[model samples]
Target: MQRSSYRYLVVDVFADRPGAGNPLGVVLDAADWDSMRMQAFAAWTNLSETVYFLPPTTLDASYRIRIFTPRQELPFAGHPSVGAAWVSLETGLVSDTDRLVQECAAGRLPVRVVGTGPQRMITLRAPRARPVGIEPPPQALRAVLASLPTAGLQAALWNNGPSWWLMELEDDAAVRGLAPDLAAIAALTQATAAVGLAVFGRTPAGADHDLAVRAFCPADNIPEDPVTGSVNACIAAALDAADALPGHDGRYIASQGRELGRDGRVALQVDADGEVWIGGHVQGIIDGRATW
Candidate 1:
């Protein structure tokens, strides 16, 4: 017996450079790939996440896609969807003439491709976010502000369906260039009732994005996410709905990964229709095969 060879492409999402954006493995035309094999491959890839593509079952459908992290499968993912959709459009799996609709565990998602050349962009609509309420475990707050001076740090909880611990910082400096205790977060996540942690605050004048953020999910196998669209989407929604966005109303940009040096920027737009649009540029890192 022999193991079937699986062909995949690696992409760097939310990055203009090779080693910058979050890396993702996109398996082109992975109809033959099973869930078990995909899970194994995802863990082996060891990237934040890997996306597998499948042909639509119905003629009216566009494409069916699945997202997997190292330890678990996700209902939705930001970078992988954008990267995979870009690959799909460029590879002719999806036509440029028609907009692409990707079916995932989260539900059907639409990705619109735009522009030509380096500035070309892809915008993804995160699953409609509802106010998850607000209150967090006490220790989770301590874990996030562990590095801070505690002068202006505050913690709260938001529980819609996914429990998120929202932490507010004094300024941009407190938000960026700091590290969270991953093990503490893992422990707090178990000890608490929340699903993850979201740290959000204003950005300094120098950063590229309007807001800076970092997310941690102990159970999700991601301690500190390089950049998470959905998490940011949820945060943006919460802020916008609560009338917390600075001078502007209902629109913002989020910066992530500054501490890890990956530094990623995500464009966010909150519409009156109650939808959040996250747009970013993705680059193809290794277009060839990985022997391992």
Candidate 2:
């Protein structure tokens, strides 16, 4: 048997500072590797998500990416997309084009890079998301919502590529104070074939962020994702559908992973055409190669 060495980079996405956001592992040149090998490497890395970069199959795309979780492969993901784009630019794989098209299971998506150096930010246009349903079935929804206040909480299921149960609490405090039943959440996600439960609440009137978010995806082997691009994207879509997002300006910041002692800031914008763009700063953490 022969072993191959592959270049890999780890980056922190949606971070206010280095090491404060979700970490993503990227295999820079994985065109030759098969799906099983990629999955094995992703599981070994033990990151929330690991991506493989390959040459694009489409004329419009600059490159292609395959996203994998420890337990499964994903059609698309928020942080991995941002992290992959950053890696592409840093490695000189792609020029400083205004925007880069990424081919993935979700299809071709556009990614834009802004700023430079530590201030550089990468934004990805989230796939179109719509409300699939409101609240899981009565019994399931009740169990999942247990141990939490329900007076003003609103719930819905949204799907872009990954399906998530989105919940809107009364305020940031309520969202942060929640003590969820992980078992029930896992069961609910399994039953609904959802990624997990994502809860958000409005921040104070004059806070720096507009919303506070937390995502739990035990079903996917993630207890709590520090910063979730996909979930926040879904949140934006849900708010837009309800006409509850900031009307004056369609741009707002979301604070997440604070409970985990991480400062994960997600930048969000809803274009006039009603498209959601999720972005944040990505910091390179480790540069190394892997052999397996």
Candidate 3:
């Protein structure tokens, strides 16, 4: 029996509170595994996404990571990046406690550790996101979005490694009340080479969050992503481009996953230069060694 050892951890990212967030699988000491092994393990775990830690090949990067969905590898992902960095810092894979740079296929990105202990927060600056494609939206979504207000934002594709079709509905109620057609969404995503579709709407005044968000990705087998960071960042970019972000300050809290029985909040910041950063609290789930 050949037992290849790797330290694995499952940490919930984007949690508003402990135990209420999207879970990410982190595999450490995975330098020995090739892409096939990594993909196989990702498929076996069946999480939205899984990540592997490897030695940094770049000069200033604290470490390198590879992201994989159950079906294929991705250049970058929001929750996985933040969750992996948390595990890295906690497991001493990284020397610095305050900040570290990550090297991935999307290039080097910065991660920051905020506060301390269980209440600590981790934030990552995503690869600069931008709206992509000027074509019309998929016909599959016409029935789904019929009569829904655009909320002053254009419906378009946003790209940040993965592409997502983002739209803003009338209000948070419209977002929370949404029931997506999985088959239609899957077909649309597959046809457009996109990961999924994300919809956001303004929450009522005085709410803890400024907006409500939802993501659907049946093409990747995720009927509804619990809390998604990448798509959140993309939506922020789109909102900023349209000048339709709530309060116009470029900093707001977004609530997601409530419809899925999970509560998670993502903090989005669009800097003066329009660079988008997403941050949230993480809760650790599983910590143990794995044999492959």
Error of 3 at 277 (Å): 0.8
TM-score computed on alpha carbons, candidate 1: 0.85
Give all candidates' CA lDDT scores.
0.72, 0.87, 0.86
User: What is the descending lDDT order?
Assistant: 2, 3, 1
TM-score of each: 0.85, 0.95, 0.95
Clashing pairs in 3: none
Candidate 2, residues 56-168, lDDT tens digits: the string is 88899988999998888888889898888888888899887668888999999988888875678899999988888644375777888776665343777899898999988
TM-score of 3: 0.95
**Clash pairs of candidate 1?**
132-159, 132-160, 134-157, 135-157, 136-157
> For model 3, how many clashes?
0
Q: Give lDDT tens digits, candidate 1, residues 1-292.
A: 3235556788777776666677888887678778898899889877888998887765655788888888777778778877877778766777774366778777778777787433558888888776543344356557656765332334555543345666766666767656667777777666666557777778666556677788888666777778777777777667766767642556677878767789678888888887877888877767665443
- Measured with C-alpha atoms, the lDDT of residue 240 in candidate 1 is 69
Off by over 4 Å in 3: 1-3, 134-138, 141-144, 147-150
lDDT of 3 at 238: 87
